[model samples]
Target: MTERIAREPGRSTFIQRTRRAQLIACAIDVLAEDGYVQASLSRIAKRAGVSRGVILYHFSGRDDLLDAVVSEVYRIATEELRPTIETQSTALRAVRTFIVGSAEFYRAYPAHMAALREIVAHSRSADGTIRHSEHSRANERELSALGVLFERGKEAGEFRAFSTPIMARTIRSTLDGLLGQMRVDPGYDPVPEAHEVADIFERAMMRQSE
Candidate 1:
């Protein structure tokens, strides 16, 4: 099985990278429209207008392709939010921007998020364990980032003393719940929901005046 060279030494050529990206996008489309079980290599290849062999040349198999899909989604989201969040004048502002930025990403890439949900919910490993378990590296990194923001705010006297882990988990859960709502009702508007959630967290975390 040839692993993608994007994450390894001697990185793949432009054409190789482009082909892998194409297959990953098609996999996301298939997972979003047809769910996890139906998103076979052949189905994804058909969506990409390529033969199954073309997909095989890029990814080892369905599992590898799904893993790439998940990683690609995270890469896209970080690209969308990191610069904006970094530009915030304060950690408190960064937190707010993170919430709003996430909403913007969800609105722009509903298919990617939906496909991620399907993969997280249904994808399994050789041992039949869930692929994207709760303690997955991606989830850990997200929580760590939020914890950093909260700690910065506290140090700056902008936030109250609180359990950073609990607060971080709550914020992440609330944001994920909005996407779940969107899945249930496609007409649901998450931007407004994000604003409300951000307001709630700001109030809960902010240190009130004497």
Candidate 2:
């Protein structure tokens, strides 16, 4: 399949796309098993059981492939969680649903989360600085969306007095931390942790007695 991607332009576009997708899936596995820097094109190709030329044909370089990896992971995660978020009737429920959904998403797609974490931890620029700012904002966008939901909750008297920025950051940080921990600790379970996190935010977001 890798050899197919390097075929002439006359090849069907669909075949090229399939080869790229296969390479990307292999890259993801390499990233999760090895750290970011170690997930070189050769390593990814080997994982895909294809020649090195196959990966180079599809991706420009390490950075480009990492970008593709991050893009795919974010796409899959968002698609998985959005429907769960939409199922809730109110902002509070949305918040809980998002958290619980995230936990379930991680459990179901551990490799996706693992690959994403590796990319963030090791993605760098030619100047030796982190190049993850681009995708980091995508993750932050989810928090911002939650912030907007919280603001709506406040307006509707569903939430208590609090700064949305801080609240959103705290919640995002907690969930992110949980994911990190789950990666390192095999014994950790996200289900109960999801409930605990939801309960914490639920209490913090509730209006106090008049």
Candidate 3:
């Protein structure tokens, strides 16, 4: 029965992991629909078809559950954004592609956006480790992609020499503002606006032809 005892723990661990995933998914749905303040463990458990005690067994409290949901949202967002960031034909194109792709991703996944907004709104008083981690990862990827484009343009003498970090931050901030406007105004179409932003960015950075 040593083998049986070992198997039992392995099976228990698998079951626990599956249950936790289910609870996290339910939490995402609840938070997406109701926001953080209204997301309760009881509601999550009910949505997950599990008992409230089961949720408590996996997560210490509602805050812990919310944290896990935020992490998952970031994970999914990164996945959605990574492909466009990695595959641009030029740095300028990459930046524009990233901006437009991100807007499209949010439009397709409004629930994820809602969940993200709730996390930001509610996490003001909590430790910011997870949010900071997510932001850092996104910034690193975006900056790296922009750096590739900046170096390419500089080598071609088609763009002005400047700090990639600063430029990346400026572009990112612009995209963030555009996204905020799109989110606030349902009638705003980000595609045309994204192209305009890209044109302005390219013109600002590129050297004038003699």
Q: TM-score per candidate, in order?
A: 0.91, 0.87, 0.72
lDDT, residue 132, model 1: 54
Per-prediction tally of clashes:
0, 0, 1
Per-candidate Cα lDDT values, in order, are 0.86, 0.82, 0.71
Rank by TM-score, descending?
1, 2, 3
Per-residue lDDT of candidate 2, residues 82-188 (tens digit): 88787788989999988888888888888878889888777667889778665776877887889888998999999988999999889888988888898889667
Which portions of model 1 show Cα errors greater than 4 Å? 1-10, 123-128, 133-135
Tens digit of lDDT per residue, candidate 3, span 1-210? 432332232445666667767788888789877777778888888899889987777776777677666667667777887776667666666666766776676677767666766766665556644532444454577677677778887887777878888888888778777667756776676667777888888888887777
Q: In model 3, which range of ten residues has the least summed lDDT?
A: 1-10
Q: What is the lDDT of candidate 1?
A: 0.86
Candidate 2 residue pairs in clash (backbone atoms < 3 Å): none
Point to the candidate with the largest lDDT. Answer: 1
Q: After superposition, how far is residue 12 of candidate 2 from its true place, in Å?
A: 9.5
Collision count of model 2: 0
Output the lDDT of residue 23, model 1: 84
